[model samples]
Target: MSQHVLALPSPIDLAAAAFTLPLFSLVLAALIIAGTLFVPRLHNRAGGTASPTAPVTARYRPEHRALGISAIAVILVFAVENIVRGYLLNLSDIVEWWQYATPIFAAVLCLAMTLALIVLKGAHQPERPVVPTTRRTWLSFSPRAVLIGASAAFIALLGTTVAAGLASSSDDRGRFIYLEIPVPNTEIEPLRPWFYGWDFGVPVLICLAALAVVTWATLRRNAMRPYLRPETVTAERLARIQVASGAVSIATAAVLLALGGAFRFIGRSGSLSQLTIGNDDTIYDMVWKYAEFAAVARYLAPALEITGFVLLLFVAIRLLHRPTPEGHGLRPQPSAQPETVR
Candidate 1:
């Protein structure tokens, strides 16, 4: 067992590339706008938690900041890598790919947060009525259905547009990788140009999941014909916010869908095994290159995806407030207290 190092190409680090503050900033701006629109409703649901830690909002707003940091991390990397490497397959300096710590970290954290949010939402049960005439507060808005629907549509359209823009770039599909694996009996099996799709998968998945929630909520709300019982509502005063939140969700899904589609086009060359260059084991040259193409998911897609992801996270946080043992379910306050009625 001998360890032999085969050399091929340089790495892609955005730090070595050109950094565009405006582009990244715009994405952040969108996230802020979207989050602002969604978080308050979440606040209402979890408002009365007995425990200070019981509130999802307590942790969520800060977590969104973390998401912003992750997006910036990717942005910085893209700037450095693309600017320095500039799509050149020089195969000399042997730059190893940058280990993306931010998104990966964000991925795990987001999962934990999302799971926590769900559990909180689920633990709630209906409150027992103390009075005869039953009444509950239904999360409501003036024109909820119409406004939310429009928002969703806008987001969807934005995603599609971005995808189209990237596709038009010189390197629309993204990057290519080549590897040299040590095979059996000293013969080397050189891997080909493949294995680097779904770079945007995390953001895409998160965004889509949020969009699904929005869709589900909208449909549920629409179905409740005459009067919406407080027990029936998952949201508290979400009608106005839903409009914006729904749009954010749709926009996220659209961008992710576009990113996936662009990757699919690049996949046309066949993802990893596109250039299977050898038969023997242990000793061959592997050439992997990151195209300096204009269409980088790290740049465009993540912004929309992450923005939507965080907003949804905020929504979930707001919707699923931490409850107390005594406050397992929310009760509609009496229409009027006994003394007041008298």
Candidate 2:
């Protein structure tokens, strides 16, 4: 037999390891709670009031009570899950199970997108409810179709993880597979702080713009509650869902990016001493291989989750102003096309 053999993966470890739905359920909960606590804390220090007339604080009616509560609850669970995965889980477990988190991420993304859709749907509903035999209208209104597409994407991503996992995370030159991730996994020099800005530069910009829009929309809508009078539940739900879902999406995306980096790191560093996973026959054979960087991958996963939290904190501060007597917390205002105009 050749001197080199692939380390058998951890037989004890489920090849498809990851947190169960129950864990993710908790993560979503924590993030939403963190947002709730964080906003008030940020604004309490500012003291000076913000402008209510701006579109930023235009939708704060009392009627959205239920939507707001539910969104917050869901987001909180995402937060908790990320934290536990990053802080508590072992490295081997993560690599084997990273695939599972992907679905949760997709779900969060859909939630946010749906929230936006809900807003659009309501605005267009009266004028556009279709008695249509046409394709465009049919696709647009079909919730079933939307669910099917999302499910397909989820299934596709699962396939991708399997393919990637089976293949080496390294290359011919021995860099992380596919990504050319830095080798030595940690030469430290090339992985310097300056490079982070360049790598994340474009995504950062896109995320920032999205962040601004999210903040402005939430604040403006929530602030205008009184003027709007018993806020439209749909609008309020949309706003909360947008923020909550966005929070989890950021969390999941960050963690995935971290995984990409870690894999690349293993490639560059030439260190796979950690992945010793496999059955008894492969276990001994796998030991000599020494290129199992599963631990490294695990370490990187948490970083992604952390990034999610920071983003949430940043957005919350910008939008959800603290409530006080001298506060500009939430103001309600009229929509451009009033239901009844004298």
Candidate whose TM-score is highest: 2
lDDT of 1 by residue, 1-342 (tens): 999999744445453232233234335545564555566654444244322222322323343333333334433443354345545546453323222222223333343443344334334443322232332222333245644544564455345434433332222334323222233333445433322323433344454455445444433332222212333222222322332343233333333333433333333322222333458453333332423232353354344444433444444444343445455443433442321100
Positional deviation of 20 in candidate 1, in angstroms? 15
Estimate the TM-score for candidate 2: 0.33
Q: Estimate TM-scores for all models.
A: 0.30, 0.33
Model 2 lDDT per residue over 58-161, tens place: 44222122223323443465555556776787654122233234324433443344345335433422322223222222122223442353334333333334
> What Cα-based lDDT does every candidate model obtain?
0.36, 0.36
Name the runs in model 2 displaced over 4 angstroms.
Answer: 1-56, 60-99, 102-163, 166-295, 313-342
